[model samples]
Target chain A: MTDAAAPTRPIILEAALDAPPDLVWRALTEPELMARWLGASDIEAKVGRCFTVRPDGPVGEAPIACEVLEAEPGRMLSYRWRATAPGEAAALDTVVTWVLEPTAEGGTRLRLVHDGFPVVLQGAIRGQGAGVSTMSAVRRRQAPDLRRRGDGRAKMSSGEVIKWAA
Target chain B: MDLFDFDEAILEADILRALADPTRRAVFEQLARREMSVSELKAGFSVSQPAISQHLAALRGAGLVAERREGRFAYYRAEPQGLAPLIDWIDRYRAFWPERIDRLKDVLKDIKP
Candidate 1:
């Protein structure tokens, strides 16, 4: 869902996956598959489906409330992302839209759009979350992609690389 | 990781609490554009004068606003740096998807049918 009053730009992270669209789509949709990659989430690939994501990492964070907004098999997946930090009343509401395209090499081109951040601190803050206003349109496409190492190990990113707000 | 996470979480909580109120968020949006005295802010908002002061105080406490005094008037404006915690959160957040997506690659390799 977008904020009609103020359409803030989204955080886009694009990647070219070695696998085809169908495989990529499955990983994004199936709960069992999603857990392996997207932390612990009960995500389903149906529009209006509600789910929760509790990212498992070094530090445990609050679970994020999510609802699927658009689910197109092998093509797109979009969801509403609402997060409440521990002890906070207001939820940081945002949207996440994933678009997948098939490449000439039979790989999948995936694009993720995360928007609906508060723009109160527009100029000074630089979009970061649904506080997410300055991470504004941080396009991290060209440098990142899924690749395979000679040892057959899967490498997902090219490491931390971004030049925000130049 | 744990050491810094605690501090960041607290800062993030403060900012979210400060802006959680729609009216206060509105107050912030107004002050962010330009500096204004409490009376000036009151003219645009339906909230009481005392309520405006309270909102300003909340914003100030969160470090989302800075106060200025001119003659007898006190003015407040948005503090850009107050959003640092969020920026930190976003950095962690932005990193989240990619790292997960990265793991997805491995999952796909194993389960590719």
Candidate 2:
């Protein structure tokens, strides 16, 4: 809700689970446990292992593409979340981090961070584009205003004219 | 945020890619606060002037920045409205986690380890 805080603010979600850290870790890492809550995923905690997570049931968004960035048993897990579609150049690329802590009552306190406030969310996660093909179309649509200026100012400035894809 | 048009969606993707680099993101954030000429912006970073210009060019390409020429100097400033799509996108996603996590709590309570 606060934009003035930092350059890129990550989304943070927290949960206090009644289970212990090990049980919470199992739920976070085990495929079956994950399917029961999060999407279905591979349990291999090795860093750099890439996997796809499909929603447990038939109805949901497309499978999310992920690569493990770090893993600490019963403590933390982080992975890159890439949700791209066919024909898109490059789309949504965000990181999902799970941090677990043992509370005084022995329950597990978990923190989830999805970074990329402005850096990573793109058409990759939401949808796909034909890409590259639209540049000519954009130029054609913009010729009325940009070209009518008639001066080389557009060319002299910034090397190329840009539209908001508006 | 309806994003019915293909171009608009690509616009979001383009901006996302533009800001993906930490350095470039920093530059944009700096400009967002106030407009500055290339030299003024360059003083904040150790990269070569051309490297800074490249970053500015990328930011401009994505429509996240606007350049103003003041005599011999061109000043760059962030177009805050350009971030509307990103903020809107995040708003949509913000609702996702809590709902899912609530479900996760239920799952945790119902399931054995």
Top candidate, metric DockQ = 1
**For candidate 2, lDDT tens digit of each residue in A46-73?**
8998887765443424466789999999
* Per-model TM-score of chain B: 0.85, 0.76
Evaluate residue A98 in candidate 1 and report its C-alpha lDDT on the 0 to 100 scale.
88
User: How does each model score on TM-score?
Assistant: 0.70, 0.57
lDDT of 1: 0.69
Separate DockQ for every predicted complex: 0.31, 0.11
Which docking category, incorrect, acceptable, medium or high, applies to candidate 2?
A: incorrect
lDDT of each: 0.69, 0.66
Q: By TM-score, how accurate is candidate 2? A: 0.57
